[model samples]
Target: MNNKLHGPLFLAILSTLMAFASLSTDIYLPAMPIMANELQGDIELTVTGFLIGFALAQLVWGPISDTLGRRLPLFIGMVMFIIGSVGCALSTDIQQMVFWRVFQAFGACTGPMLARAMIRDSYTRTRAAQMLSTLLFIMAIAPIIGPLAGGQIIRVTSWHAIFWLLVVIGGLMFFSLFALPETLLPENRVKISLANVFRNYSMLLCNREFMRYTLCLTFFYVAAYAFMTGSPFVYISFYGVDPQYYGWLFALNILGVMAMSLVNRRLVLRYPLENLLKVAVTVATIATLTLALVVKLQLGGIVAVVVTIFLFFSMNGVIAATSTTAALDAVPSSLAGSASALIGSLQYGSGIISSLFLALFRDGTPWTMSWIMVIFTLSSITVLLRRGPLPENRSSLN
Candidate 1:
């Protein structure tokens, strides 16, 4: 292994490319209220559109990245993102903004899927998990800083400036990605055939263990999405907190995730990925259940709810990083990108479904979010633990 090729600098660059999606999503959240007023539409509708666009775009970009090489697709996605940002900045109507948002999200999906594929391209399961955790430690900055930045931007100028900022970030990411070496070697590249693509997907679909592990991560994401979608309402509408304060609350969860990611990076070398996942899922389930109990009992106030959700989300970083490594390792290197695509499609698919459900159940109360989190977390735990324990090294089994 070349030290220069896999050093922290490369990881940091890769993480930034991957975190672009999160930044695009979260950075715009603080502006949602403003966007609604400016566009003369309901705030909830605008937010839901953004979530749907981002989630659905993942399904398209993931397979495209797998079929085409990672680089070209990434470059194209960046260009599209930049265009979308400009369109958003210039939009005067809600319909036009929604269209641009969908366009923007089409480009945002490339980072996470390809970043994971690149890790599988280079490292073994445990090392891949560690590398993912390291990348996440860098990626965590998007959620922590995106809202704060958006708030400041909104305070100084209009929400349009936020879109312009994304335009700059997208352009920078486009050039920076050129420096990343292609990790999917020609010998390991899958043929871009419809038949082969379907065959590969069928094979993955038939694997019970793969589905179980992937769903575990997906369910956790459902909880996360529920929090993202529902929390603003809970904090601002129900509890009467300011939007800036909500950004700080969101940043607290990001901090928890970053802390757990650091812990995962350190422990992955010493422990089996499966054992770590088991522990993480167990902790997350317990935390979610505890939160549900607190909400049910009306224990404290908004503070207790925030603390519990933060703890639940903290375990997600570890579970997601490990499960992704394990799932990608199940396939041959030739199919790494496709495998990553499927994992992402499933994860965000769950997110889309959960977000919609939360929206439907939303009543400007914290209980709705808490109950949904508990249900998904418990279901995930049941599925993951039902198959005995996860294998020590998933790649060896493959």
Candidate 2:
């Protein structure tokens, strides 16, 4: 049962599935202000609703994927995504839109969480990192094009049209999954029992290395969510940049991720995953602190801000792939699905908290945003330093 499909084809399918999750969030970002105006509600509240919906749904989907197997949950998730997109398109009120967005996120979680687990099931640590880098390289195109596409869609049609576009993408992905072979073996599958669920979760929770990497990854997401929630306000309201211009800024930052991911893919073969993660964390800490200082001093304009963010997000491309490979490597075969669930929950759970903090401290100032990123980056570095380095070989974990 050599389940390893052609590398390029596997990557293509994985990237498409993963990109659907992100496209659902980011493609509509440029339209947030528009959605607020149309729905007759505060933009912040509407945005918060979407984030909340997305984060909360992760808990349910992960356990389901672990119990039921990857393919079915993924199919159900895609269907839910399509339905949510349709619901969003038909929504007439903010509350209605919020409900549908929650529905949407529930579906979106299937790909990112399960996809990582699937990669791990098929490949070793170094190879998993390589595959993820390639998958991320393709998935990176989503953020680059999503906002731009959404912007153009908004420019030409109503915001509802964006949801319609999501519906179409979801449909395509659903059809594509029909050809995607199940990567998780039956011998490895866990039955959906409450006691078994808690037992597996306890195993993950008690592992020092798993906790360390999960926290490290979570903090990184916190930093990202902070910037994402604040950047539009900072760029548009304070700097007087038009919303459409944000597409280019967003695209440029993603390009930075793409560049770093390619470099990491090459470097992972020579340098250890742990070493790469350490370097990435260190660079990210410095970049984030620099961003904070620049904002405090009011040094430069949008270019400075964008460049700093680009550098910050570039680190994410490396750290995310590294931490994922590390976490998945730590899991025993029997608990791989549970391990995947816990990691996904931690990452999105941290995002939920970070988004809350961003909302609370939002004074419409760049300083507030920078401070949040600084806090998250420093926290992640602190966790990694305490844990020391990751084990060099996956075979040792077994």
Candidate 3:
């Protein structure tokens, strides 16, 4: 592998790498209904199992990248990803698919965390934030087209094709890994120590500012996963929308996300990230609360729910980038890999929690999804308002 890649190529590679996580989730969603019907198991658990693997793998990949360097972990992850995808494609039952999805997710989550970690490796705080906004903007293409593509594939073929497509994607990623530079410098490497990983997390926990933003970011992911978990059922089962069109709806929301991200990228040139964050969260909270109410009252029906969902999702464009940059700003650059890992773990951890809530409480209503979004967004807002700005310092790692 090259010790360094040209800048444009690096960004492209990193964005695709990170985007794979969302790709893993969104691409398979359209298959959920048919898969559940065919395999005679809970559709919800299949998604949940994948998410659990995706979320938890950060714990291992992030720290290992810190010790072993970025490229090796990514290569390992890609291999595992292909194996998992193949397993999913060949699955005979929901249980087997769920287990394989976990393996797949274990491989998938590494991309985004490593992408962020690598950004920290190559740039300063503010610049890294800008780069992240750009990366996420490009990354949107995966989720944007994923379900739509999945829907089309399912229409033309079967759900099994989706995993086979994933297998191809993972294979391509594996081969492309050869071109990516090892962004982790030797001086920056942490000694391979379980104790060191444990200690790094403790340090993150103690940082008040980081924790505040961390909570905010995690809640945002919770809201997203909640939406993702419930939407197929709500749209297809409850509203009678065609499964073929689910991707179109999801893509429309992502367009809003892209627009907001572009707006933030331009706005960040003139305004502070904190100021923008406040406005974004405020808008999201209001939109989500209203969504919950509309769901409860059953007032405007599916159209209303869809509009409100879009409003809530649009805010994530700002929330994800700003909140991530804000949280990472508090820690030393040296611990970027570990910090990125911790953030990914917490984000997915929140997703798992949110998904579980949907499984337990949802009764084929969009209300469960709406309420969870409201709860997570409001909680995020409260933290920002109450916690205030944190004092920056080097990590306890040194």
**Regions more than 4 Å wrong, model 2:** 1-4, 191-195, 396-398
| Model 2, residue pairs in steric clash | none
- Which ranking of candidates, highest lDDT first? 3, 2, 1
TM-score of each: 0.93, 0.95, 0.95
Q: Lowest summed lDDT over 10 consecutive residues: which window, candidate 1?
A: 389-398
Candidate 3 residue 238 Cα shift, in angstroms, is: 0.7
The local distance difference test score of each candidate is 0.78, 0.80, 0.84
lDDT string for model 3 (80-183, tens) is: 99999999999999889899989988888888899888877776566666788898898999998899999999999989999899999999988888888888
Candidate 2 structure, TM-score to reference: 0.95
Tens digits of per-residue lDDT for model 1, 1-398: 54555677679778997687678878877777678678986555544565566666665555555666678878887898899899989999988887887778777777787888888877877778888998888899999899888877877789999899999998988888878777766555666674556567778878787777888888888887777767777876778877776789889999999999999998988887778888998898888888888888988788888888888888867988988887776667767776777787777656666667765877667888888888888887877787755555644411
| Model 1 quality (TM-score) | 0.93
- Judge candidate 2 at residue 192 and give its lDDT: 62
| Candidate 1 Cα outliers beyond 4 Å, as residue runs | 42-60, 192-195, 392-398
Task: Report the C-alpha displacement of residue 35, candidate 3, in angstroms.
Answer: 0.9
Please report the candidate that would top lDDT against the real structure: 3
